[model samples]
Target: MTRTVSDVIAALDAAYPRELAEPWDAVGLVCGDPAEPVERVLVCVDPVTATVDEAVETGAGLIVAHHPLLLRGVHGVGTDTTKGSLVHRMIRSGIALFCAHTNADSADPGVSDALASALGLKVLAPLAPHQVGGTTGIGRIGELAAAEPFGDFVRRVAAALPSTVPGVYGAGDPHRPIRTVAVSGGSGDSYLDAACAAGVDAYVTADLRHHPAGEQLEAGGPALVGVTHWASEWPWCGQAAEVVRAAGNVEVHVSTRCTDPWSLRA
Candidate 1:
């Protein structure tokens, strides 16, 4: 069976509902001929230079990513800049680009949910529960049936995530048992205050900044563990692929390239 770009977009919209995206997010089709037939789709956390090349090499007709290739309006698509070059390449190759961004973040079985599940944590409620009916929000708070030591949870997260950079910063009592957990997929230091308010024993996500991690720990907030931002959210590709596959018969491939743009060798 054949499917149009709009058909695939419709299926994604039915599940994620583009309207659910935060006002500032750039979600939906960034580039593509919607009427073109889609035989293969690449699902990724970020649509960076390498991921785009991967999609083209794989003969993918569409690229579905978590981060928007064009988050803000682009003044030009000239190859002089990185993003412009990518836009030019996708346009020339006839590969569509679609992003699910904040919409995916806020979805019930969204990025954080997938991350939490990876560590066997059960979502008790949202740490920053999204307001229903298109309202914006933050991360989620969950519970582990049997509390695991913070060190144990860290190992579980590191094992579950794809090949990623080990975090340079860490805080809090590593040996303490962690029961209640908070999860936010992307750069989540901004939400430390909220996580603390929720009273979660540990907060796990990626890209923890120095000030927030230091201050939060010193101030006696949730014990924080950092994962690669890309690794943390990559699980959603499978989850989203499952959603898309359930909606239609199509090939959904998860891109293997990290697209993280970082490698911590030490």
Candidate 2:
């Protein structure tokens, strides 16, 4: 069955409702006409140049991204600027761009859910429960079937996530036993308190800043597992592709190109 851009969007909204997005977040279609026919969709963590090129090369009619290309307000989108160049490229290539953002994070089978499941954790509940349609929330708290040392768990995390230049790192005692785990897929420092309150053995997340992480550890919180932002969020792309595929008869491709800004770490 042929599906238009709006049809695919409706399917996405059903899974990750835009209403669930934080007020500050920008979610939904960034470009393309509602009536435009869509047969191929590309999913990725970021809609950067590499992913855009992937869409063009693969002849994808639409891009469903976890991060919005234009999160904040923009003055212009003329071909000169970085974001503007992306806009022009998509327009010229007849590819639409849509973002899921916080909405996907808050979905029941959301970003954190994917992360937790990837690490073989059985989900218990949302770390910060949202009183919405379903049991959707920002982060997740789960339990490992068997407890393992912090160091072993860190290796497991590194193994689970897509390998990047700066692999996963951990804080707290390497010998500490960890069973219960709390995870947030992207920039999860804000959820440290939630993870601690849940009394999990470890908190796994991405883009953890030095001060917040150090302070959280000083306060005797859970062991911290810090991963690259892209790795933390990449698992959701496959899950999201499933959602899109269920919506219509379109070919969905999850871009494998790593768009993490940090190339090499000293």
Candidate 3:
């Protein structure tokens, strides 16, 4: 069976509506013709050169990336430049590129939902609800079935995420009891205040910076578990692949390559 790029995109957009995307986001298709027939698709967190290599090697007809490849404007996509080479490569290979990005983050069973589920949290609600809708927002508020020590919760978080160089690090008393928690999948410092507002026992997220982590802790916010950005969002690749594969006429696969840019932790 075969389906057009448009068919696959319709399934994705229906699952993660473009209307739910932030105003500044560049979600949806990045390249490829809608009318082009597609037999296989690859899903990944980043739309970089390495994932592109995986797509080509695996003979993928389309790539459903969680992040946008062209988030910012570019002068041109000449083969000489880095990003341009990727665009050219995809074009020549008859492959299509599409991104879910913030829309996927804000969807009902979105990025944060996947993150929360991986750590065995029972989802309660969105950490920050969307302005115009219910059950759709930036992050999620959830709770474990039973309270555990913050240290144990931290270990659970680390084990749940894909093993990475940075791994997972926690702040706050190891003995502190953790019941409710909040989560956001990628670069989630922006939601630190929101997580606090939700009054979760802890917050699990990626890319926590020095000052923000300190301020949040100093202000008596939730226990913090900082994970690598790539590891945090990596679970969404499998979730997305499942959604696309169920749409039929498409063989979906999640890229196993870790495109997390951080190489050395020490």
Give lDDT tens digits, candidate 3, residues 1-266: 67899998998998899999988999999999999999999999998999999999999999999999888888899999888999999999999999999999999899989998899999998888986458999888999999999999999998898888878899999999999999999988989999988888999988888898899899999999999899999988888998898789788889889888888966
Task: Score every model by TM-score.
Answer: 0.93, 0.97, 0.97
Each model's number of backbone clashes?
2, 0, 0
Off by over 4 Å in 2: 132-134
Q: What is the lDDT of residue 220 in candidate 1?
A: 85
lDDT of 2 by residue, 1-266 (tens): 79999998999999998888999999999999879999999999999999999999999999999999999999899888999999999999999999999999998889999999899999999989896344798999999999999999999999999999998899999999999999999999888888999999999998788998898899999999999999999999999999989986899999999999889878
Give model 1's clash tally. Answer: 2
Candidate 1 has what TM-score?
0.93
lDDT of 3: 0.91
Worst 10 residues of 3 by lDDT: 125-134
- The sequence of per-residue lDDT tens digits that candidate 1 reaches over residues 1-266 is 78888888888887687767889988999999989999888999888888988999999999989999888787888899999899889999999998998888888768888888887888777667665433235577789889988888777777778876654234678788899999898888778888988888999878788887888888888888887788878888988888777657678898878778786676
TM-score of 3: 0.97
RMSD of each: 2.1, 1.4, 1.2
Q: How many pairs in model 2 have backbone atoms within 3 A of each other, for residues 3 or more apart or on separate chains, i.e. clashes?
A: 0
CA lDDT of each prediction against the hidden true structure: 0.83, 0.93, 0.91
- What candidate 3 gets wrong by more than 4 Å, as runs, is none
